[model samples]
Target: MHDAVIGGGRSPLQPRALVARSWSRVLEAGLDPDGRHPRDPLPMDQVLARRRESPVALVIEELRAIISSVADASQFLMVVTDADGIILWREGAARVRGRADSLGFEEGAEWTEEVVGTNAIGTALAEASPVQLFSAEHFEAEQHPWYCTAAPIHDPRTGELLGIVDVSGPAMTLHPAIVALVETAVRLAESQLWRHHELRLERLRAVAAPVLASVTGPLLLVDDHGWVAHTAGIAAQARIAVPRDRRPLTVPGLGLCLPEPLGDGWLVRPAGGETRIVMTLDLTGPPAVAVSGERPWRAPLTARHAEILLLLHRAGRSGLSAAALSSRLYGDAEHVVAVRAEVSRLRRTLGGVVESQPYRISPAVEMAVLGAPAG
Candidate 1:
């Protein structure tokens, strides 16, 4: 069925829609269906660096405890990769591990659809969802002997993709429950990640409690993402614009403030009662908003938010309505809801610096655009 559908581009027994889509993407990316591609896994030192940097590393023991024992007993390999689909860890029976190595399924190997054709790891990453592929369902002929099930793990705080966890083994031994097992493990991992986040916040609250008691005015102790860990005098807000070291943030109740790092988090104090903020919007390079002064730090902006800010700044006091903003951004007003949603996120990043009667910069903010508004 795989050859008939992918080779001849037609088959009476159609591949699953997801599989077919992955095959199309692999072909479009110029990956060969029949030819073998040899890859050199990244050097052990570099692989170690990535492992140290990946959040997945913290939960690896948990994953190994849950899946590695099963893989070893079942003649399978438990694999983990960063969101880029680069394999970071692989463990199982030595014999099964050897077989995987023959297929270049080793630590540090890039296994995305473009790199190695459609399979569980690559397809899961490409689709940003779970995937299971067996035998001939794989795009690369070399992978026809194996079955793989994989699911993505995401950061509980940001929903940013952390990595993928996969189980792969001989095709004939593929159990119907393998995919479910992988999905369950991913859920457990994400929950554990959230638990870790809460624990960190708890530590921050404990450390800052004494310091906060001494401070008199309305202020907040927030993490790097602007999550309020502890509030001194102000009503607590769930979040403000993300805090960058030394960057001035126009916090809603706190006014413009500079966030200074303290231990694991930052201490956000009103900037000596200075209510006005000066920001530079630089589109000359990768679009970043920079705040300069005693404590100066820069935060990179997403393209969407950058464009929205530019449009808002250009509009001046009038601001752009959701419908008008939608039309300007998407070439149609059909995206009004999307435009509004994005503006909400943008506001979270800039706090009171962004206002939404229509969506314009706050009058208290002095923003200067750098380079062409081409972003």
Candidate 2:
């Protein structure tokens, strides 16, 4: 029920009296005649669950270099606390560290805003701001002797609150450089964490390249910022070159530009800040689209499906008979029958739009847009 008096001691103020006054204010302002505070409290089960799952040590080694550097240069002690306020790591003077731990302020102790009321470490996290608790400003009577400074550590990329970095020792001995020092150190730790995750994702993608190519079809892996990351080898067959020009490349036939380079031969489409992979066959071999009365519809062209279409476009006529077209296409009678069956399936799929007429392909319904636009 204590009012929290927060901030660095800027004026000529007695720290203990400020704490007492703040406490009295909070109790008087918050409590009704029934002595109840009008606020919904969080469930302890959910709080414990979130705290247990927090991974503070995941980047402890990376952060250690900065924490040690800060602690070694400053007279104040440095400690890393998990999201739950449990001190996970420390680097500072041995004397301060010992005294802090002896006062039940060591690793595994929950010093969260909820548990300790209002203190430098807990309050910094609650308010998502840097805090400086001078002597006697701490919520608890026992903690009144020490002053503490803390800042919330966040994942640089995601901006998620990771933990807290704090420096604590005796109060009344204020140093000018403590706040800036802790803030800069926390920022460095966050930068390291982001770099670590980025490297990890890059390595994982490299290892999964082969399998990713096979299952996801031809694709291009792009970064979050719309730059092409990976291009598949098969993409070479397409007119568009993979890793093209160190930027997003245009698809040869499709009217789309990929965000990231398709190193794995995949192109991702961006819509509303979301990326999606689109699968398309390489059409660089030849134009497969044909026009009406262009070429006689061939029964089957095994090797020349693409080339034959081009030839048919140039010559305005129907195609050869099944056996004849087969020989013309691949020079085989059995293959001609197979091609005919495939063409039949194509007709079925095309429905009434495309018609199979002897050795000719005709559009049952004239399409206003057919073949290349008349030059």
**RMSD of each candidate?**
4.0, 21.8
- TM-score against native, each model: 0.84, 0.47
The model with the greatest lDDT is: 1
Candidate 1: tens digits of C-alpha lDDT, residues 51-70: 99999988998898889878
Per-residue CA lDDT of model 2 for 1-375, tens digit only, reads 222233322455444543454444434444222222122323556545544666555566655666566564455577787665666666777777778766667656667544554577777776777888875566566676788888998867546678898888778656878888778787777777767666755764786476565644345454433224455543433122223222222343222333333343344432222122221112343333322231112122233343333333333346455775566567677686576665554433222122234444332222221233232
* Stretches of candidate 1 exceeding 4 Å from the true structure: 280-309, 318-359, 369-375
> Which regions of candidate 2 are displaced past 4 Å?
1-55, 70-75, 213-375
Highest TM-score against the true fold, candidate: 1
Q: Residue 56 of candidate 2: its Cα lDDT?
A: 54
> In order, what lDDT does every prediction score?
0.85, 0.53
User: Cα miss at 314, model 2 (Å)?
Assistant: 57
